[model samples]
Target chain A: MPKKADNSGSAGSEETLLDAAGVKRAMDHLCREIAGALPGDCPVAIIGLRSRGDELAARLIERLAEGGRGDLLHGTLDITLYRDDVSKRMIQPQVRATVIDFDLDDACVVLVDDVLHTGRTIRAAMDALMDYGRPAAVRLAVLVDRGGREMPICPDFVGKTLKLSPSDSRRVYLDLAETDGADRVYLK
Target chain B: MADKTTTTAVRRRSGRSSGFVWGRKHLLGLEDLEPAELLHVLDTAAGFKSVSTRSIKKVPALRGKVVVNLFFEDSTRTRTSFTLSAQRLSADVIDFTGKSSSVNKGETLVDTARNIEAMGVDIMVLRHAAAGAPHLLARKVGCSVVNAGDGAHEHPTQGLLDLFTIREIKKKVEGLTVAIVGDIAHSRVARSNIFALRKLGARIILVGPRTLVPDQMRQLGAEISHDLDAVLPACDVVNMLRIQFERLQSAAFPSVEEYSRLFGLHAERLRLARPDLLVLHPGPINRGLELDSAVADGPHSGILRQVTNGLAVRMAVLYLVHQAALAVNGK
Candidate 1:
């Protein structure tokens, strides 16, 4: 169910574009749920798919730290070339660096993404992740789990679940006070 | 069944074992190689190394085979080594550079390869600027595929020669620490070395700037470090890599001087290594950038030894892959 916009902060104020505080709260809740699910002292690492997911992973790291959990390994992954539909794209996509500081062998990896939809991107991300090292298990975590999975996939922890029409496009925007004035999401 | 028996009988009658021979095919990447298969290629290469040392210098192993050097990129050392190796094994060599060929005339890579294969070329020695070009060509063509060097991908022959060179210098690969320094991100040599060295049981340390070394390299079981001093003392074989300036359009670093100061192997740095630490490079060295000339041509330098072993290793690779192809074809 889509949670009602919490109006405590600027989300209810006239300056509202989208809810930055609301997104943070939801991300924090999702992270706590994931942290609780992990076994004791089991080496856990979070690999964020590049671009927005990488930023999401970094933000999640800070939230995890606030909850007194500082033992998780963090990494950023690039899956541009590994996509099955790469050749069919009109423009040659930009390739980014994959940064996994630790070996994935036997480590429980939580693959964090900003949004989950058709499941195609997640599949490519998983393939790209495997080239680096074999993880014992991989779980998916998304901020928004919009229900339109074309492939056999489910998110382990989801911040919010949204139902959308087949033609509708949903976009998530993350902004630093340093880049843009605030953070938000929009649907068109 | 009769055709298969006849082909086997013909192979036996030729006084060559119906099992395998070296010059009739190509030697692509090592992605599909098992430990025993890799050993077979190495041991066969050792025999060819002996043949390379003989006075006659020529072998009839691939007398009628056509070995085309389809290099789509510029490479003096690797191209020359492959050409010489093919000639030594009595295969007719066709060397094509990208600029002078039909590749410049808007022809696709597969079309060009097919045109050459039409000329009865038995093996193709390919070197392209894109990773996986050889594998793509191998899938399209009926002839054998030998990858000379694909873009930051794999140089299997170079890797084999490096393995051969390391084995010759240290006499064993089982427990040695091999450090590959410089431009790890854009190096096919490093890619191949990782696979070859690991398969042979050597520990690998990849030392370079964080920008040049991919973070995923740790997944391949290599320890990544930016500080050369930290890794230098522990390495048994210091394999220096060439920093191809032509490939670098913009400076990956602030300056060459900064790179030299941080990562370049100078005389003082060499002194910190073990007394017997064998220094190596897949040559055309950028003297001051990745390595100092003093260390490159120094007493312990095995850079030239790597070049020499290139001939023997290529000869062995050609011989073994050809044998495997013949065995599969029932000849």
Candidate 2:
């Protein structure tokens, strides 16, 4: 859930587009939309991009359960080492496991993430997913769509679309099973 | 101020919820590493081992990074392995040997290193004839330094790979009796193995001639045993270190007959050891001089596994050093 905190005396101005309650409702709606269009005949793998994406994917799976498709295949991917601009980054890329147990030969993969910005993350996910096996189709889903796309890629399902400028920040603070406990998407 | 750098990473697929943190600007030797740090390298290498099995055995971990191999000494095996390991991680590698480089034209080591660093190399893999040569280079260069082999000081990766091989086969390091046989006094591999194995909780016994196994070997926490047969039964693993004839001064051991008869691991001695005994060599093996051809090729041998694990071990070292360098510079 997204809980936007108030910053009355900060240097920069802020806006709370959606709070924690709003995020849960948005996620519910997004899952309903994804459930309606997903191909039922084939094996649909709900793959989440690693770290925060896995958290978002877990929430999505819970929401999808309400729509009666809880049995959908799930996996998590780490595209850190797979990134094209790895050497350019000063920080060491933390490599985690990439678990895709089911065969992707003819599966429909719903790639999930928390925020959509440069669209480069999605592209890297696509490239990494290719190395496992060619999926029949791949549809992307995200909670917040802060549209500043550098790539030709776009999300299939977006919960909230915020057209923020370059200077504005969209920090999607998350509380996942594996990370520090907190969840909110603060736009400033 | 913190660099506020981000890696753009994903969830931990390593069955853990947290990221791995490693901090150390350079991997000077295993002697400097804590037990946890050494184990971490082995664990990290475990994740990278599967890369070799992939159809495209390349990972973009170090992609676009420049790695320089500066060697005052010639080492085809070590150099080639480092190149392949770096390339497998998608890093562009530059090779510079003493014979081919300007060092032959009277350029100082520091001058040579500064010039290479100016070319924007992110890491330097150095092997020099002098002990602590890489340590000097590490101090001089701003980039992360990996001591490939610095005379007799340490050949860290080689030691780690041997450790990796042992862990790979035996499944544990603690409570294992590992005997290091041959050229203890002159072998850099011995000096490194002593540090690594002793730190990892292995019972190490140095087995060779009295002249070859110096009194100083006891300081590394390894028992000095001149008789290979007496130690064979107690040892779970026997590492036959290469007899570096080039490094030897006059006649340290009486003769090949005397040395081989006393220390060589041949078939007759194999029956005396535990049935599950493992044999290891750091390679460029003197088959007849140290261990017989049968033992080197037998099922009990992890010599070839040592070679394969060498690649993973080196990859782990390179990746960890880069990670360390990032933490230091970023902070």
Using TM-score as the measure, the top candidate is 2
Q: What are the lDDT figures for the candidates, one per model?
A: 0.75, 0.81
lDDT of 2 by residue, A1-188 (tens): 12223333242444566676777776777787798888888998899887678877877887787778867889888777666544343444445567777788899999998778778888888877887788899999987788878799988987777766554433433344446444456643
Docking class of 1: incorrect
Question: What digit string (tens of lDDT, one per residue) describes model 1 on residues B94-182?
Answer: 99888899999899999999999999987889999999998899889988888999887899988888888898778888899999998
What is the per-residue lDDT of model 2 for residues B215-330, given as tens digits with 9 covering 90 to 100? 88898899999899889999999999888889888888888887888899899889999999999998898878888999999989998898888888888889888877866775
Query: What tens-digit string does per-residue lDDT give for candidate 1 at A17-129?
Result: 23778676767778878878875556888888755677778878877877777888999876654454422221122233456767788899999987787788898888667
lDDT of 1 at B269: 86
List the candidate 2 regions with Cα displacement exceeding 4 Å.
A1-76, A83-93, A97-120, A141-188, B1-20
